[model samples]
Target chain A: MNILAYIIQKEFIQIIRNKAILPMMTVLPIVQLIVLSNAASNEVKNVNVVVVDMDQSESSRTLNHKIIANDRITLVATSFNTNEAHFYLQENTSDIVIEIPPDFENDYINGKQPKIQLLVNATNGQQAIVGSGYLKAIVASFNAKLIQKVIPDISISKQSNTTISSRYWYNPELKYTHFMAPGILAQLTALLTIILSAMNVVREREVGTIEQINVTPLKKWQFILGKLIPFLCIGLVLFTVGIIASKLIFSIPILGNLPLLFGYTTLNIIAVLGLGLLISNFADTQQQAIFVAFFFIIIFVLMSGLFTPIDSMPKWAQQLTVGNPLAHFISVSRKVLMKGSGFWNIRFEFLYTFILAFIFNGLAVWSYKKQV
Target chain B: MNTPIAIELDKLTKRFGDFIAVDAITFKVKKGEIFGFLGANGAGKTTAIKMLIGLSKPTEGMGKVAGFNVDTEPEKIKKNIGYMSQKFSLYDDLTVVENIQFYGGIYGLSREKIKEKTTEILEELELTEVSKSLVISLPLGWKQRLAFAISMVHDPEIVFLDEPTGGVDPRVRRQFWETIYQVAEKGRTVFVTTHYMDEAEYCDRVSIMVAGKIEALDTPHNLKQQFEATSMDEVFLKLAR
Candidate 1:
């Protein structure tokens, strides 16, 4: 116990004494939060679309007005000829084109479905899907208007059958910053703490101090646990800082239990620190340890369901994601911050993180050598 | 009993797969003795030191360090010894005082004890003025000296040094020996290994390993006479060749 405390104290002192590391660890997260929040949003607005109106009538003008009025679409260009519209599409200047045929008015008057062609760019699959929905809404609204005009004498009721009062639940506005900031905090803690602990051991080996420790009465478990505890504290500090950033800079509401979030974050730090120690035991060089740590972190962050919904992913990918601690953390953080889910709701996530922390840290102790 | 041996080994052997690192060897070091472990490149000096430190498990044989079994009581062995390796062992980014405090803390030293020891070690090394300086910024000689002192922070029964003076200049090596002498004078056992044959002369007794076997073990003077050589280096050349 004393030896472990000594190791923890040593690591903390080293962290405090190093001028470059402390500032870098603290400031990098804030800058990343600001820059990444801007880029990480799922909402893609202002899609550029061109209008090609051959009819040039009131009906065609009204349809064009409706499409442009939508916040999703922006009018980038207008053309009369199909050839000119095709040019805009080919040059990638337009994401969508609404073509009103010359016989569009005739078709409407004759009680036939109007033939308005929507040419959409499918190269960017996501943008294409969204563009199609926007175009369909405009066409549907226009068709309804035509129906009302054509059958004015007939007794009819025009009202929506059912209305959905959607409540965003956790984060009402669905701000990307709110969702991402907590997860990034978790990731930063995992990344930095693990690297430092793993490097601490590797550095000892490289510099020859390990031999000193080896000859001492320090147990392998003591050494590993000592290293793990200090890093765990560092991870928590990073988590607290991330929460502050989310509230002040991102204006993200904290809906979940703050104490619960912190508890889970602490568990996550242990799991990550265990993983780092495992890497430290495997790698003989500081460089090797760093690269291995980076590889695992990348894997954990990507499969964690931070950016995309894990449910939407393939079965195999989802199964692999189950082993990743970040996956559960990202979900749990969002649930608490966005939905304010209680202990029962987040029990499964907490269980997995706790189990992983124990298993990985145990393995680190098993693999650790007090000598040589 | 005349203060039981600090280290005792009986038929200690180590093998990495089929390659024998340290062939079955027997030796003993009395308490407070400065024992030199001398060997040529790949001559099993490191392997032997590792076994003594309880870092490596012997393929065959039994050993005891500070009266603790190498197999079951490896942890106990660690509690009783200090070690310094050939590499830069201390944290390069940590200040001298910070490193001492950390090491002292792990060894179960109280905060007051750590504070007192820090001042004593700094004063002894005349490093009080720059105790806050990062280890990386210090000269190589200074770093080596600090590393030696750090290993002794726990005040162990025996201090194992594996080529602690590698890459250090002769003046630094001499200065390092003075520190070793100081530790020995305090009744702490100094078990050191080095490629520099000149260092063997400083040991109370020396053992020369060749081809994973101890070819000679004696006071440097007696070994020189037995090999018809005036220096430890010539004695090594005669036996190694």
Candidate 2:
């Protein structure tokens, strides 16, 4: 125990003595939080739209005017030519082209469903999909407006049978940043801690310091613990910094127990640190450590449900999330912070992350060699 | 000094899959003696030293370092020995005093003992004036001397040096060897490995390895006479060839 304390003291001294560590720990998270939280939003606004009104009917012209006036749509060019609209899409100047077929008013006045053509650029899938959805909402509202002028025989009360109302739970405003900020914070915390610890043991090896430290009477578990305790504390402090950033910058509500978030983050950082140290054990250099850690981190982030919804993923990919600690962490971060969930509500996520922490740290300790 | 066998081995070996890194060999080192481990590159000198210093497991046979089993009690052996690797292993970013203190502290020394020993080492190296300077700021020779001193922080029964004077000039090497002599005069066994056969003459006894086997073991003067050679280097050439 005395030896462990001394080793810990020695590690802290080395860490503090390193001039770059302080700035990296404090500055990196802030930059990442500011950039990533804003950039990773699921909301795609300002989609460039090309309008082609062929029928020149009241409804078609009105649709053109609606598309032009909508805040989310950029009316780059509106023309009577269908080919000209296609040209805007080809030039990459427009994300969507709305083509109204001729005789559209005749069908709409008779209460017949009119077919409106939508030419969407599939290159940027998110913008294409969301932009098209917005255009449909506009068309639906216009159809409802046209329903008011529906042949005098059809009564208003009979025509409007169903009107849907939505109340978004957890995030009433449905602010995309509120939903995404916690996930991004989770990602940044994992990324920074992984990169920081991945270089530690390998740096000792690269600089030839491991050769000295290994010969000491330090047990493998003791040495690994010495390494882990400092990094765990560092990970907590770094995560605390990120949590503050999320609140201050994105206004992600701390609705649930704050200590629960921290406790989970502690478990999450341990899993990541264990993974990083495991990489360091096999990697011969700091460069190798970072690269290998980077490869795994990319896998972790992409499959973690951080940027994309796991429910939408293929079944195989969804199953793989079982092994990914970050996925569970992001889930708990969102649940605890956004939904005001207690430990019981997020028990499964908490349990999985805890299990993953043990597996990873167990592997790290098992792989570490005191003698070979 | 009373416990005469500092190191003893019989057919201790290490194999890397298909290739044998250190084949079965045998030797004993006396307490308080400076034993020079001489070899050409890839002659398994490092593999052998690794076994003695408890960094590697011996594949076959048995050995004891400071009366502890190499195979089973490497942890016990670690407590009784000090090691200096081929590369400079002290933290370059740490001050001379801090490095010494850390090494002593890891060996389970108390704060006061570490502080006392730190001062003693700094003064003995005549580095008290620059004790606060980062080790990186020191000359390579001073860094090496400091590394050697740091290895001795535990005041162990035997010190294993894996090519400690690797890349220095002859003058620096001689100065470092003089420090080794002073340490051995205190009746501590010194086991040092080097490719520099020229330094072999300074040892009380020497062993030359080639291709995973010890080719010769004797005092430098006796080995020279036995090989009809003028110097240890000439004797090394004959044996390695």
Candidate 3:
């Protein structure tokens, strides 16, 4: 019976009745979550390597065999010609060419530093970086084996050899979907909120209903909340659907508290809705609102660390991520869902996000002028 | 017994930078009277109505609508008046009854009151059979009529109609004026702006605006008599030229 209730009811009726928007809100997020989660992974697998074993020794043979032992690294060909291996790289038949020099075994046996050259095609940056890393680890393990072969009863100084037994904590197998699903959920919710909130009032303005509504006794907050509440509810529903899918479909771990994640998610939705409201204020029509939302969504999604890690970004870009709401949501989602992060661990992200929400909603509400 | 003034404007002006959109316009309309605002394109008709309807602030003037100050008491004024624009502003996706309910509920009407009003308006408009249909499916003339009825859903003391009958056939336009007449007969002031000259003759009083000022204000008969014109269209043409 409240005025705000009427406005919100009207918005729901319209949203339900809209053919374009209904599918976009319901079917689109489901498909985006499923497709983008699978498609936007960063894991590089099955890098084909050409072993140019010029040494023709046991050490070279052992190293080449060990490298191709895993499913992640496959041996395409073994050749004595370096030029032929280089040709494989150029022709795109191989991603990495591991060349073993003639004295590779003897040099290691004579207490000399031995080197093996790796010609890696860096066209696909992630594959090159990760694939080359796997190759180096294999070669290093071979050097450790050669050191332990009891050469002339020499007691080697063990102080120089510090093997790092690294253990991945959250995702032990480094499952890409587990890492990506929560971030994708955050991205989709933020995106939906931004789009719906941005367009609601703008749609009214385009249809000229805003002119009629503006002349009414409808409070400014009522008009704004009327637009916001519906989108906020939709954002939450979208987030919930994503959460369920991430759990049931992807089997992504729910390490942190559900109530806490839901709380943070609600706050994040409000923050994004605030941003959308700000956009609606500046845009005179629905098309303008969508274009403006698109511009921000692209920047926000890219900077959100959804597809890429924030730590890998340049210093200034990392600093810019501090203001991005999507970035904060993705970080919080991953931490809570993957790392079992408690409130104390994510307190900074929550605080910064709250500040963003405050500023955005405050400015948006302030900029709205019913009289003008 | 005399009717009270529904809207009063003294030196109501609106300017944008160096340009005067509505220049020192002054007028008053009694309650329950039909007032037509006649103007050429860009003749400051919309600007003046905006100020009276509390959508705009007067650059330098005093205005009172429904016994509330335009500038200072805008919130109170807003509650006291209704507005229907030339766009026939209704949600096309919403059914006719739903639209009525939305407007009524927004005006703080109870659910029962909204239902009662919905039934009354639909019956009066002879749209009871199609009340559950989407407004977009309705004919243009019917949409305009529904828009007028919805604008009065709150039972406001005054309803501002901004070209409420534009683009409709003459018969539909005449029918639209009959609804306007019915509202005025129920003692609600109707302030309307229109491009149509014959529509001016239906108003109890019409004000002709030229450039940024009201050049003439009177009954259409007196305007015809003064200008030696046979019809309201000839009188408007003479003043416009």
Better of 1 and 2 by DockQ: 2
Query: Could you give candidate 2's per-residue lDDT for residues A42-124 as a string of tens digits?
Result: 68878898878779987788878987888998889878898888999999999998888888988887667789999999997
Per-residue CA lDDT of model 1 for A111-145, tens digit only, reads 78778888998898778888888889788878878
> Where does model 3 exceed 4 Å of error?
A76-93, A105-112, A147-152, A156-164, A314-316, B1-3
Provide per-model DockQ scores: 0.60, 0.81, 0.81
- In Å, residue B32's CA in model 2 sits off its true spot by 1.0
Error of 3 at B117 (Å): 1.4
For candidate 3, what is the DockQ-based docking class?
high
User: Candidate 2, residues B1-241: lDDT per residue as tens digits?
Assistant: 4658999999998999989989898999999999999888999998899999889999999999999999999989988998988786988888888888778978899888898888888889999999989888999999999988889888999998888888889999999999999999999999999878778999999999999999999999999999999999999999999
TM-score per candidate, in order? 0.90, 0.95, 0.93
Which candidate comes out best when scored by DockQ?
2
For residue A65, model 1's alpha carbon misses the true position, in angstroms, by: 2.8
Interface RMSD of every predicted model, in angstroms: 2.5, 1.1, 0.9
Considering every candidate listed, which one attains the maximal TM-score? 2
True contacts kept of each: 0.83, 0.90, 0.87
* Residue-by-residue lDDT tens digits, candidate 3, A1-372: 398899989888887777887667667777877898898877786899999888888877777778878789888998988888999999999999988888988888787887889999999999999999998888877777777783745676778766679999899988888988899889989998898888887877898988888888888778877888888888888888878877877899999998999999989898989999999999998899999999999999999998888899999999999999999899999999999999999898899899999998988888888887
In model 3, state the lDDT of residue A322. Answer: 90
Model 3 chain A worst lDDT window (10 residues): A148-157
Clashes of 3: 0
The clash number for model 2 is 0
